[model samples]
Target chain A: MNAPLLKIDQLSASAGGAPVLHGVSLEVNAGEVHAIMGPNGSGKSTLAHVLAGRPGYVITGGTVRFDGADLLALPAEERARAGLFLGFQYPVEIPGVSNAYLLKAALNACRRQRGEQDIDAFDFLNLVRDKMRTMHIDEALLTRGVNEGFSGGEKKRNEILQMLVMEPRLALLDETDSGLDIDALKIVGRGINSLRAAERAVVVITHYQRLLDYVVPDQVHVLARGRIVRSGDRALALELERRGYDWLLEAAPAMA
Target chain B: MKALERILADFGSPADAGPARLAAAEALSTHALPTRRDENWRYANLRALEAVRTFLPGPAPSISPALPPALPGYSRLVFIDGRLQPQHSLPDTALLGSLRRSAAGSADAGPVPFAFSGDGRFGLIARMFAPEPIALRVAGSLALELISITTAQACGSYLELDLELAAHAQLELVERHLGGAGPTGLSCVQVDLQLAEQAQSTHTRLLQGAPDALHYDTVAVTVGAGAQYLLRQVSAGAQTARSTIQVRLSGREARTQIRALATAHEAQVCDALFTVLHEAPGTRSDQLFRGIASDRAHVACSADVQVSAGAPGARVVQSLRGLIDGAGAEVDLRPRLTINTDEVQAAHGATTGRLDEDLLFYLLARGLSPVEARSLLKWAFLAEALNAIDAPALRRAAGQGAAARLADTPATELLQ
Candidate 1:
């Protein structure tokens, strides 16, 4: 589909000298939603952090492309500027820096890299006000330091708020459902659903099928021992939830 | 000669000697000022202070400097070389009254002649062996009261402000050490403030001292029962400015908070020592000090907390965080606690680190140049404690002093 928005060819990432994702190849066409699911140690979070360019995660051998650009060669921030976003498994707390300020800076950064002049603060705040309303994110939260002292639910919502503001082309949700209640799950899922667009792609990383119930992905892949050993439609997630990954391991080879 | 020794010798006689003459004494103390060579004082430069040994101490005739007075509003304590220059001070109409008059005028005023000793600027500042001390008593029960102290001269000086805060009093003491290089000299000054019963005294000290001078000052606060005393100090990477603070909860139900901050650049060294003694029942004390060091500068200090068994229902938490950068830059933080009681809550933590790379990436990705990102993070380290100040002017001024220090960094882009 028009030069896959993101293509990961045989991607392998490691942490602490131990490999997590091993030779995993994936491709996401623009406007596609790809969900990666597996049992524990499935490297879901690793892929998210590695994709985000967090330090300590080494990409051993692979090529990541975004909009046909060499994503692997770019810094995490540059990748972000190129329309990539990662909703962290654990949103970091940066005390003293207001969330609104950070989001505005991030949005302007992307715009500047895309050859647009910076928007004035007055206009920028007005734009953010609309996005905050759709996500149901508290304007008060935006005024506080970035995620500092926020509850588990608030942090997840804050991440979605950033996604709403940044409007990245490729968004990676890393276990965004953990620590969220049913009500919060619906709110977060609705937030993600609203972002679905013909020009945007999303990667949902989850361990529970409950999250999939709301933010249904078009495709789901099971990762075991680092490699994705199974792939299918949304039903695969439900199947894995019914019978854990151990059953699949009996039928599959040690792909990792 | 070592800067501290020269400082001690200079103050040894400055009725007006102003720490300027000790520049000639042989630095016999084999103890080198902390350096990259020394482990504790590793982040700070000991030599920059050594070179400052010769500048004569004098008052700045000029209007301002790279680092000017941040807190412009307040009754200033103007000192030059250990002597108070009343001429440079605010108008004589600014003098409220004598300590006794202050206590007598306010219905909430308490006792007088409060004193305590803790190893720090106060330990040194307390050396006013003279029987008569400078006393300025304040009207009790006044809200939003502030006293500003200005170190106008470039030499070592001693200042003792005997303040009497009547019961249920809220007092804000803003002390700004303003003045730049004069003969490239150094100075050490002592500041003492006394608070009365049920009084809430919030003290914020902004360091705009001579870049190359040695600033060693002390704050002795003896809080009364049901009284609240909060002390906040920000240093602008002094050549060697060490302000020691001693807080003693001598009365039951006393609360004391000590938040001291230092941001050092180049080879300057700023150290703070705090001695908090929980000697009374139901007393509480908290200490948080963070230092951001860049360019081989050094900031080191120790927080000593002593909670005797006699003081039950007391809680003490002390935390020290340091961000050290550049090859030789270092921060040495030591938090010592002696708790003889089994019923009190006591926690001590010390963190020394460089700028957070992840946070740095997050900021730089947001379009902030690398320098601006680092500056924001450094300022963030201070906002928690400084923001707690109620006075907008003093808070803004404190923030300015912090920003000016960071602005001197070679890679700083935020200042631009």
Candidate 2:
């Protein structure tokens, strides 16, 4: 009876004058995690970026609605304040902004947007420390520049750390498990799973099914050639991991 | 012609000026003020100097300068306008004394090192009328602070500083220049430094001038064998300011490192020129400069590093970054390296760009507004240079001052 938390209808987008997503549609409800898996160059990351309002992507047609609001109309930062978060695949390395300072500024930004007072510096530090423990992040890294000179696994953990601090209503995690090791993947998965609640939703875009094993998805969709060619459940990801996408491509030769 | 007459009248007579001043004046008379054709003056136009030409020179301000927080076991010298304020300066010890009093019988009685340059009209002008310098010699590890103040009066002022460190000596020097509100003033400063064999020196300079004052500074240093010279500078708050720093590694294994940060706002212009020469084998130099401009401001940094023909194993590296935040904000960065030697390592990088879009989006996704995100990035761009400062207190103060200048730039909002 209630509208889905996110609904993408006939969304078509182009990057650098080349169309990447063509007539792709999907719906995600709260309290559920959806995984979109495909082979390389399947527009998985593009969908995440478009949803997060990244520039350089031209939307030719279709619409995206979040909580029944026209999500496409909001700016990137405004969308963030309205409870949308994106976990970058390759986290940006900012050489001068300390991790702790960034987290505090971001948390305060969200608080101000909700008409709430900012957290005190001491309290903010405690909050970050607790999250850092769960994320297996070093406290020393918090004093250094954001992701500057951080290892691949450390950068991924930082992305999740930020996600935990923001507690956004709708989160898009783009290949968060790509560069992470096995242990890091588990920690990141546990961190994401902890945020699962009745009022929040997540969309995980991954190429490998190993991530889906930790963060079990309620639904799995196969995207290829700018379109979603198949949709299934947990079993679907297992099948793709076993048989690869050749079977699906053979079935939809024209679109592939 | 009228300006020269006014200068001579204010200066009294060339007879009183020691040989250094006489020679400097003769050179100034022979070589005219630099024109646009001169490479050094190409980016800096001094038409405004003519406006303040008639402003007569006045006596040094007698007011006490505001002393900075003292470092433990350190020495200090305070100067107002160009004259040394002995009562306000630090207590004289065995290591520090007035140049006139100490140099009377020492081997240093001759002309000060690096005090004369043919291309410096302002340097020559400063030499003609400036009082004796406040000098300090470091025989052991020492920390010194030099404070120069310009009051509301004394519209045109000249000051000079001279330092000679003994062999194997170690010194850390901090220079602070404060200018109060004044009639269109011109403040000229010359620093002559020499580092004996195996000596080490770290120098930090902060220049905060009046909104409409003109500041001209020239510094020359020669490093001996196996010596090291490290200098960091931060300048702001002047309508027109120019600094020329020259260093020559005159002996084998000598090295120099220079890190400079400059900012300008509200129609101000700041220029920095650096020249480092490697004349001895195995000498090295590293130079980095960063500049930020907003609110119709202009900032420029130019550096040249030369490795002489026979100076093998010489190395030079340079990096420059500039950020332009508002309309009409101009930033120019030129890093030039000339290596005449076949076996030398020299490299340079210079870039002027706006905030990165991807970086902005990352910040935005974390819930920061467009303006907040932009402000953070802009501040970070300048903080990169500030962090290189070794003194924590100075670094903190410098970072805060840079932020105040950047507060006027409005946060950039998303186009959508």
Candidate 3:
């Protein structure tokens, strides 16, 4: 339905010349949330990076179609301008570039792509003030260099803040809940939930099921050794939380 | 005559000069001009200086060139072609009074006064041929804007400046060196700074020479007990620009900071050398330099920090970063820290590369194209040193100018 916001078929990739994601396939439709739960080294982050067009990741064989266009053919910034956003697991610290500057530039790029004018300075400030409040971030952090010296939880919140401002069509959250505490997790979950709409899609790639508890996913998939072995509903996440991933890997030799 | 001989002939014989000038000339003859064999001149050749030796000094500039607007709240002292243009400066009775007289009298004013010692061949030439040496005894918080303009291509120019600060005094000085278009011949400047106990000074030098000009500058400073000193130098638009800075921390708790930014594009060559000596205990020094080389240009920086054997509790840190974009662009960066005492802390680093790929990718992910990302990262790298400028307005102006100049360089793609 609706051309499936994103469709990946037989996607095989490698990072640093080593095979990571092997023939992984998935489809995400607009107006829906999907959860990918896997153990470490299951190519969870690799899939997210590949979708965002990060360099150093070789696509051995695969196809990623975003709204009926080849996503792999675009550059990183082109992908970003085309409504594809990746919330990095470890937000990079860029010195001398303020957070506000980064967000304004990113938002203007998306706006230009959408045939809209750039936001005025005064209006931009007001908009960010509101987003900061919703994300529980300090206004002082906006003046600081991008992610420079930011705490783990603060960095995650900043990611959500950026996502909110840009409002991309497809948002990929790669382990956004990895180092966040219970309170931070709830805030991030709420920030992400507020952006969910009938015309947007989100893929939450995480190692634990706790994040899914706050922002429940409509579909849950178990990715083992770079392949999606089982696909189910919310019950699958609950079962994975109770049974862990080892059982799934042991039960199916094909997953190995 | 040889190149050095021709230069010496323009200034006449050393016998007619003052003691300092005589000593400088003798030193020049004794120690030949710097050569590639010298470790300090490893990356810079003195052939330009040799080529300009035959150019004689022009007549004193009759009319001063239109100088840039002064930084607000600063008094001006303008010099054109090595001659002081008092008509263009503010009326500082004491300052003008000293300029009317010989500077030799003021440099040797009181006990423990400051003086210049010739350290290189160019220093000697500056002393021997310097038309007018502006020497001053500063007191009671002084803010000054000094402009030195070089005109008349057929002739050369040399300047010698000596300034001493009294105890507990403060000084903020900005020096601008501008050369005429299509310039020829050599321009040499020597500045000696002597800070008394508890004195503080912030010195900024903006050096802009003609695309074909040659320049040699040397600054020697001695820091007293409980004194502080900061020097920020930005040099650009020169065919061959060489700067040497020497500092001696002679008293306890004396602190100093040095930041230098050099941009060399086209066929320009920019060289900076810093030698810091720690002679007393509990002294500290921080040095940083940033260079951008493009289009077959070259930039070189050499920093040497030496702590005496008995100078304990000394701390020193030095960092150098160079951006080399385009084919044949070269950057030679050398940072050395020699600590003779076991109780000292010293760290030095030198890095020369195009740019950080991960940082570039991070910016790209923020929706910046490749060119925009490289420009931002380049500005960020140079800002690390530009932040050392104490004046906010001046820093902002210089930063914007540098960014605009660097924005045109070709972006080196992330081939990695």
Candidate 4:
């Protein structure tokens, strides 16, 4: 933890100049896994998008540092090439571009930024073959267009496959477990765990504690009204599962 | 000078014997409007054609135009003002040499067009200009071959052409019609094709109408035994534009398919009509045409199909769509079916609509500005239709061309 992988200081954001996330702060250290669980409109997805530099949500206050560099100043792809990745809740469908081609493009984009010549086609194929075998994924998935006409489980696993291939320094999984079955969940979790390293960090955003059972996180936080109201170890998620947001509502009126 | 008019008057009066078939035909059809003399000139307005009667015969004016590269792995031929410009290219092959020689010797004989079945401006020019027929003869079975046509003039007379492909040859043909509407220019074309047994062909046309720009073109496709044919035509809003495709399957086990799509802007009119005929038993045909009119642009589209009796295995499918961009854009799409054969599966459908709400929402939610979202959907819709091209280069170029015309949409963000 000499220099934590990502540091967020009093970060605030607005959509159409109206507050969405108000004074949110968090930290993720190398090799650590953090989980953010919240109800709808709790800004869970917004936080993931902001970190990936998606357009339109203006950063109003505070700062975000990823690997010692400013995160807010980069474009979405630039942030990606900088070792930050967001597995979209709803993966896009690029009709003519095959999944393998897209993944390779992303890998090359990242490698090029790090001043490395892109992996040749033969090397890329070999790399993909190995990753697919380990993740229990099939080669046919790579031949089709990116996530096009994919089933719910297929889309989620595709996201994990992307994560496995890119091996980003920081990965954000936005509701990756939402539409997946228990078996698919186990596969995704295994894929994530296999990549755990001191050079990388992970943040899995979910609406329920069910996902925590598969990929245990070192830290858990409850976010509501654009703010993280509670923080604890793995037990915090178990508490939210039993109690819901009832106590947060009871405390907010008096605090106001 | 109206190339057709001034020159034709002199040749008939014997002050000119410059009968380089194309040159001679240009002179004869150069009149102002449908006079009693022009055979194919009755239904459409020739007022714009007449206005340019005094125009000095200018060179094929120098142009600085650009279009998207062809789909990968395909041979390509690009043309400007109906003349194959040196700037465009095609893959090297013997078929390439044959087609070039055929065009120069142009329009060899074929069966006569059934008179009065399809008519107006382009028909007149086609009948009057190329008596022999501009043929695209395919020698053997080949893939990934493409041909494109473009017009970039503001005001000019019509250029009549006859395009034909011989039996046993296979390829993809793309006709791209473009021009400036200022000063009221006119372009007219006639394309004819032939496909033999075990041969396949596909044709795509993209056009926009000018306020005073009157554009008219016709396509005729004939297929032999066990051959396949696919045709699609797309139009943008304009002053007036009309394209008609007539196809027939004569040999047993022959198959044919046709589609037409149009997106019109303000104060414009477009018509995409198709005629399908199954002359023999075991022949099949399918056609779908969709059109959209936005920004107060109006369109009149129709389809006429006839399947001769005794063709027990004829099949057909057709549809049309139109989207009204603004308050004033208008569209008219019609599909007709004629069948004489029993035991046949044939269907035709047409639709005219506004922007699709679901498609719009999906794109906007992804951080694309509203305009950018609309533009992507527009191009995607056209791309799906163009994707049917056997030649990837034709598909890529058509998609890129249609996307560029959507200037208001900032699609430049994702295209590269």
Give me the runs in candidate 1 sitting further than 4 Å from their true place.
B1-73, B76-134, B141-160, B166-170, B181-183, B356-373, B407-416
What DockQ do you compute for every candidate structure? 0.39, 0.74, 0.66, 0.05
TM-score of each: 0.83, 0.91, 0.93, 0.66
Off by over 4 Å in 3: A250-256, B14-16, B53-55, B62-64, B91-94, B98-119, B404-416
Candidate with best TM-score: 3
DockQ of 2: 0.74
Tens-place lDDT per residue, model 4, A1-256, is 2788999888999888778888889999999999998889889999998888777799989899999999899766677778888887887775544577667766776788789998998999999988887667779989776677888888888888888888889999999998888888888888888878988899999988888898899999888888888889999899888999778756542211
lDDT of 1 by residue, B297-416 (tens): 877877888898889889999999988867788788988889887789888899999888878766654445566567678777777777776677667666776776664332222222
**Reference contacts preserved by each model:** 0.28, 0.77, 0.57, 0.00
Query: Once superposed on the true structure, which residue ranges of model 4 sit more than 4 Å away at CA?
Result: A1-3, A16-18, A252-256, B1-120, B131-188, B194-216, B222-227, B232-243, B248-255, B258-387, B391-416
Least accurate 10 contiguous residues by lDDT in model 4 chain A: A247-256
Model 1 chain B: lowest-lDDT 10 consecutive positions: B20-29
- Residue A242, model 3: lDDT of 90
The Cα RMSD in angstroms, rounded to one decimal, for candidate 1 relative to the true structure is: 6.1
lDDT of 3 at B135: 77
Per-residue error at B35 for model 3, in Å? Answer: 0.8
